[model samples]
Target: MHRDQPPLRARSAPELVPSLFLDLDQMLDEFTRLPIRARFRFDPDMPAVITVEFLAERGPSLVWLLGRELLRRGVTAMSGTGDVRMWPTLPGGRPASWLLLESEEVEALFEVPTAELAEWLDATYRVVSAEAEMDGLNWDGFLMELLGGPAAASE
Candidate 1:
């Protein structure tokens, strides 16, 4: 999924903000069931075609999976808190491309994209999947770390 260029801002105001709830299982399921070809466009005149098969082939990368999950769930709108900031180092103690999802209530960030996010999704997926397999852990736990959601306390 190679985007022709960087994502261009919409000519008009952003869409209405919807009440958001994080559902990781649902997000993963949706990604798995994605069609062979998906199109995303800020404007109807210009749409980027994403090859779902390519992403699926590589398996899930934590960063790419988070990006895809956020995008699929329509979580892109920046809340006007002005709290979001980019750090050279991520909270997970690694230097990876990512975006900070910040607010007064939460201190977490996810991957950012060098290319169009859609394309980065596929690239990261390929790398992360291989890394996870090599590390001998299931992708789910690795994904949970990258996502930074509520983790159940170990008894």
Candidate 2:
């Protein structure tokens, strides 16, 4: 994480989702702030998506929150990809596995049992951290832009 990274602020779900979808550079900036490692993949036969690996050293609260959000947005559990084993000097490094969340996968996974989702969220939380908060940027305004509306920037 950068020393000057901003803090995480409370934003509505609609406000944040658009940022994840359009602001690639800002999303990358936010991703780098977390201790966990993830990758963006696009296969010709499959929809483009990201694969996140929850690593150790990240705070559990953060991981759980991310897991919950991912689950809410339809992320899926992956198999035969690889195992999540512990690495030295990392947090929640062990006992983790991969989740492959395609556009459809996310839609279906979002319909799963909340209890199961919570469990996964807890597991990921063991090593994740919350993203840095934005100060002047009004995330809601950015979302409006994605909806084909004018973006009303904060003064």
Candidate 3:
């Protein structure tokens, strides 16, 4: 028998400024619309890797909280061969954009206006979300056909 995991609950707000919290909330909302690909590497020398891709049905609240915690500790950007990317939104004139592109071997920072950041995030979210939705539908069809016999195959 298969059992569904319980829903995740967000932690209480950290001691961040109000504006930072607002920005985090806005970004979290956008992130929830798309699927996020994450990879964790525990050993630097080993080829072993763990990867997870989260869809809209599974929220990334923990990711958001971790980003906030990083910001609180004064981390602006981080990237490596790992599959996860974190963009910690900070106050003041700090860079509002951070990207960890593991496949491209890239980790960078961008200082852009808030509106521009939001627009970029929205565009990326739309593209990724659409792709994720299609992938999910395809997987569902495959499973149905596999488990339900020939009658369930798609035309």
Candidate 4:
């Protein structure tokens, strides 16, 4: 029997977008992308990333871990440089955002509804403000993990 079902940490309620079809123009040659499941999630543990997971019938689920701040600015205008970037679009009279994930090997583009993404970000802010995100982090522990060694923690 499970003693505790839900974890103690607060998770920002994920925003669900149904039938979030792609808005293609920049990359028409690429194959059509039909997003079966798409949502934005924020975990208190990983407060920096506003993760977006795209689940399709074929192949593994692709995920993009974008900055929470970047997404907030992206809804209204362009934000970010290299690696990741996003901007609002009005392709075929439908409102959407162009989410670009780039790497040296390959690059990908995703079109998400502007309103949906905006609402999700708003909901997350309601649960946890930006200033409060850094309150409980163990910086020394994080650095130790990065350096792969036992490092001293500072208060």
Off-target runs (Cα >4 Å) in candidate 3 are 1-81, 103-114, 123-136, 140-155
Full ranking by TM-score: 4, 3, 2, 1
Which one wins on lDDT?
4
Candidates in order have lDDT scores of 0.31, 0.28, 0.32, 0.66
1-155: candidate 2 lDDT, tens digit per residue:
33233323443332212112111111123234223332222111111112333333446411211233343333233322122211112234332222332342221111122233335344433323223212334445445555555433222
**How do the residues 55-153 of candidate 1 rate in per-residue lDDT, one tens digit apiece?**
223565222112333442222343222443332323454322433444566544433322344354444334334234234333454454456633521
Q: What residue pairs are clashing in model 4?
A: none
Model 3, residue 142: C-alpha shift (Å): 6.3
Model 4: lDDT equals 0.66
Which portions of model 2 miss their true places by more than 4 Å?
1-94, 104-137, 149-155
Clashes of 4: 0
TM-score of each: 0.21, 0.21, 0.25, 0.72
Best by TM-score: 4
Summarize candidate 4's per-residue lDDT along 64-99 as a digit string, tens digits. Answer: 788998888887789999899988875575677787
TM-score of 1: 0.21
Ranking by lDDT: 4, 3, 1, 2
Cand. 2 TM to true fold: 0.21
Clashes of each: 3, 12, 0, 0
